[model samples]
Target: MIEVEGVKIDTRHWIGGERVASTRSFPDISPIDERHLGDLDAAGAAEVDQAVTAARAAFPAWAALGPTGRGAILRRVADGIDERREDLARVETRDNGSLLRSHRRGVMPRVAMNFRFFADYAEKLAHPGMEVRGHRERITYDPAGVTAIITPWNAPLMLATWRIGPALAAGNTVVLKPPEWAPLTASLLADIAHEAGLPAGVLNVVQGTGAEAGAPLTRHPGINRLSFTGSVPTAGVIAAAAAPNVVPLSFELGGKSPLLIFADADLDLAVDLAVEQFDNAGQVCLGAFRLLVQEPIAEEFTARVVERARALVQGDPRDERTDVSALISRPHFERVRGFVDRALADGARALLGGGPNTSLNGLYYSPTILADARPGSEILTEEVFGPVLTVQTFADEDEGVRMANETRFGLAATLVTGSAEKAERVSEKLSAGTVWVNCFFVRDLGAPFGGNGKSGIGREGGTYSFDFYCDVKNTVFSPAGWRES
Candidate 1:
């Protein structure tokens, strides 16, 4: 255990494969009870520079390892994560306020899968050569020199792996900056990577607030590529920093995704999905914030959704029976509550819950549903990023699609329909990067994941991820026969 500023912390930053402490540190507070979990070292500009320089120095040897060699290490990393899955899951849940059950059954396993998937992909990656006339041309995919991966607090380790797995698999040295709010699991991951036989300086971690560390890291000349997952405003700031340097970027920002429920859809599944909007306290980027129901069954659908949401148990996240828990922090909880209050003042009726759960001492808010939210209302337009759902009715298929696409965000959308033809047709018309039919949040690691418009800038996962982390160069040379000529 380590202490900074009188507060005790259980973790430290990993720099050049060594544990390092920072001059300044901040307390890590648990949203579950507003308790001080520990103190996290705040990486300032100096630390950021140190991390970047280390990554840059290590890039050559790591890249020289070739895909097969890198893949072997990545596979070992996956095995390490699996070996420590239970402990890592608990750490993540305790640090970030995510349910223990989610980390155990879902998040931790996916972290391992991410490494395994990218390891296999690295081996299968090929840059085939082509013959044009008498010249032989070949395309080579080279790792982007040094990469900076900034992950969000929502799912720290899981999301970090999303970037780390691909970046390392492509042979790029990484300087990962995990969110200060939830930095524990990331620290653990660094230890696991080292144990998996990753060379010193190949992977490094910096921990601090966005202003102190993130800004300098983004602007650092040593970094060749940047991948970020967070809010749009933050993305803009990062983009500006990278602009002068022309560093390639991949951004996965916020979303106010819509879930359309057609007249002929299964009511049971629709209600289940509607309640899922409140999952993770509605902190998910791809969460369904707006519900677009066909006019004929609008009233019934809303009623069922409200009923199901009200039934969710609000208590300790560690409890197996608890369905809803505290928000990430007090400020975030208040911000989410403010959205509900403002929407209510704007004449939107609360169909179920609309206030904090006073019974709970922590930052817990009740699952809320707003009915008859006007077009362009804040509740309908802005991202609440909480357990709040806004319901609107549409008369026809075209109206449903229009209402669903009304927001500037185009990250993800869900459509439930019995008709196969209608599902395909409506999915095509939706502007979101990902469109789900009869399902919500089902992920395939190989599929392209991202958003269109204000949602984000580039895609991640599968070939898309591999392409982003690499620089594809084409080389042409004269054929043997042509050289003779």
Candidate 2:
């Protein structure tokens, strides 16, 4: 285990396919107690250069491995992840303050499944069909030279694996720049890659702040592709930096997604899915933050949802009884709290909660539900990445759909309905990349995950994700009559 700030974790930055020690460092805090979990060292610019050089050095050979060999390695990584699933879940719980039950029962399973799904799905990535009507025509798919994967603090390890699994399965070397705020889990996973026997320089992990580590990695001339998951502003900068290099990019940005429930919907099922949508303190990029109910049943639904949210047991992540955990940091906690206060000032009432749990030394906000919320409030319009939900009521189907679509962000949205026809209609009109029918967060490892509009670009979970990290090439075969040149 790597020791830092009184907490020891089995973490290391994997570079050139080996675990390397860090030189410069900062404290890794546990959201639970605001105590120093450990000191995680930053990967200096020199380290980034080394990682990039290694990725470039190994690119040609790895790209030449063909889909079969590349797929095999990815499958093995999936197998290894499953073998160490408990370790991963434990580390994630401590590192991120997510409930152990959720990590073990839900998150870990999806992560491993995603790895295997991509391993098999990569083979189905059919090459473009060619035609030689009068002249020769051909199309071939190949990997982008090197991929720089920058991950966020929320769901760090899982999100990184989703991108890393597909990129490597399609044979692209990777250099991961994890959020310095949430580095341990992702770093540990990379170290595990070495233990699983991946080739040197094929994968690298650099832990540091975005400006120093992420910016340099994105702008690095040697890097040929970028896969990022974070805020929209941050993505704008990354995209601009990579534009000069013309490196292909898959960006999963912010979301102000809406969850709609009609008067005819199943309230019990809606409650369960609603909680799932707000899990990880509503820190995920998928459907979270907003709750829209038909005004006819609005009062009843709000009461039920508030009771359920407040009933949630919040405590140490390690405690099996804990239903929720701490927010990532103090500034984040203050930001969310400040938003809630302003929301109240704008004529909103707290249906459930809006308080700090002082039991924890660090940042901790109670699961909150607000009612009588209007569109003008920032809480209703912007993405609130915390354990908070703002309720907005609409009169009819058209209004609900319009309200759901009225946002700059459209990553994912959900509709709770009994009518299959209505669900399909809503799905078609919704601006989100993925629209869940009767379920808010029933994520499948095999399904494609991404966004449209300001939520960012490209998919990241299955074979389609693999296509994003690769460059397509066309080869024409001539029987001595194929080329006019």
lDDT per model vs. reference: 0.89, 0.80
Q: Predicted candidate 2: what Cα RMSD to the true structure?
A: 2.6
Report lDDT (Cα) of residue 247, candidate 2. Answer: 84
Q: Against the true structure, what is each candidate's TM-score?
A: 0.97, 0.94
- Model 1, runs deviating above 4 Å: 2-10, 127-129, 480-485
- Candidate 2 lDDT over 1-485, as tens digits, reads 66533335655567787667777777787676777776766777787898999999998898888888877777777777888778888877777778888888878877777667777877777756566854456766678789899998888888888788888887889999887777887766775677677788998888888877888899899988899999999999998999999888888899988888888889898778777655777777785668888988888887888778778887788889887788988878888889888888888888877767666546778788888877666888788788888888899999999999989998988888888888888789889888888866666666778899999887866656756877777777665654566
Could you give me the TM-score of model 2 versus the true structure? 0.94
Winning candidate number (lDDT): 1
Report clash pairs, candidate 2.
Answer: 4-38, 4-39, 5-39, 16-201, 17-201
Instruction: Report the backbone clash tally of model 1.
Output: 0
